[model samples]
Target: MVRKYSKNDEGVSAVIGVILMVAITVILAAVIAAFVFSMSNGVSKPYTVGITIKKTTSGAVSIVNSGGPDVGQLEHVYVTYQPVNGAAINAYNGEVPADGPDTDTLFDYIEKFDALKTVGGSFTIPAEGVGSPNKVPPTTPTHVIVTGYFKDGKQQVIGEADV
Candidate 1:
């Protein structure tokens, strides 16, 4: 009688397969968790607000909140005035509200709170803000650029109007 040698390798492959499946599942779960957490902590939707720029006969520029979504706690507003025939004037900063409103005032307050406006809010650009020491003659052919900054460091070009 001859003695034969047998190799018992049946369980080796099954063990490796199970381990690989478990590792893949763990990795997938980790990826999904990271995505969910990031989404939950990300920035929310941006506030919508409309602005209008106009020039008064007195040569002062006006920024009006025509209508739009309420932007809570504005940080600042910047205005750029470009006269049709003259150089552009920059570096005018807008004022923020002293406090946040309890209810929606987006369209209620007009110009009383500097650049921060409720709907229908209107702000007049002072002569000094426009880089003029004295009364500057109002120019019809001018472009008024208005920008609004929120507390979140996000800014929007509220409006650009030619007057």
Candidate 2:
């Protein structure tokens, strides 16, 4: 006696189930990867800076980076002078030298004046620029405001001193 076999489709559901599971797993993995990368590559926060100011008899002002963030992390240093009895003005606004703060001694704040490049580094305020010596003369009580700028254009008032 010969036996005849009947065709059946019972395995179709198993194959489709496997495909669906694989697709779901792939999608989940992609989403997780996106979240991980975004968290790891987020923008950096701004840094804090510490500075010291000194005024000379000749009407020259000097500054030193006392503490806070490293010099290489800064993009520029901004200085503003506001006389007690006079209008406020900008003393200096210049980019930090790409080479870093000059190590040579600062004879006067204006001598080899470099924007504060390094911590414990110093620079002179010249008689030039807007709100500078020409406008804010020495011997007058003034408020000096120093700011540190980041490469991203964010800035923070790092130091303030009355001279």
Candidate 3:
């Protein structure tokens, strides 16, 4: 006797194919949802401002705002001077030592920068004894750092140079 095979198994295969397709669609939707939700967190970006620092022949350090999109957002700028042989001196709001006439002059420049946050703004910290006391010596290289405070309560080191 010869046996005959029929197409009764077709229904079973169709059912499995449908289940597999549904599973794949669910997994794809989940992946996409996770990606979409993860990017909605609010995070502020840092300000981008151009700054230039240089040491002049007179042994003074000059800081200039080269102008950038974020320059208008600057609220104040602070300068920190680190000499090769002494403790770091910060010139902000009259923080420099008052023992010398030069320090008083340096403080004045810092104050002016803080007041005027304009493009192409520049200030010079005079060499030691000239107007800045020994904090910035002429013979020794000093590290000058300029930090900008933004109106959004963010502070960043805008520029640094060895002068």
Candidate achieving the largest lDDT:
3
Give the distance in Å from residue 6's predicted Cα in candidate 2 to where it truly belongs.
73
> What ranking emerges by TM-score with the best candidate at the front?
3, 2, 1
Kindly report which residue pairs in candidate 3 clash with one another.
102-131
Tens digit per residue, CA lDDT, model 2, 68-102: 75557776676667666754554543322233323
| Candidate 3 or 1, higher lDDT | 3
TM-score of every model versus the real structure: 0.48, 0.49, 0.64
Runs of candidate 1 exceeding 4 Å displacement: 1-46, 57-59, 91-113, 126-129, 132-138
RMSD (CA, Å), candidate 3 to true, equals: 6.5
Each prediction's RMSD over C-alphas, in Å, is 8.6, 9.8, 6.5
lDDT of 3 at 2: 100
Query: lDDT of candidate 3?
Result: 0.70
What lDDT score is found at residue 154 in candidate 2? 73
Q: Which 10-residue window in model 1 sums to the lowest lDDT?
A: 94-103
Write model 3 residue lDDT over 1-163, tens digit each, in one string.
9998776756558789999999999999999999998887766687888888888888777788888889889987877776778555664332444342244455355565673267888877766523323334534587777878788878788888887
Query: Model 3 TM-score?
Result: 0.64
Model 2 alpha-carbon drift over 4 Å, by segment: 1-46, 93-114, 126-135
The alpha-carbon lDDT assigned to residue 49 of candidate 3 equals: 83
C-alpha lDDT of all candidate models, in order: 0.61, 0.63, 0.70
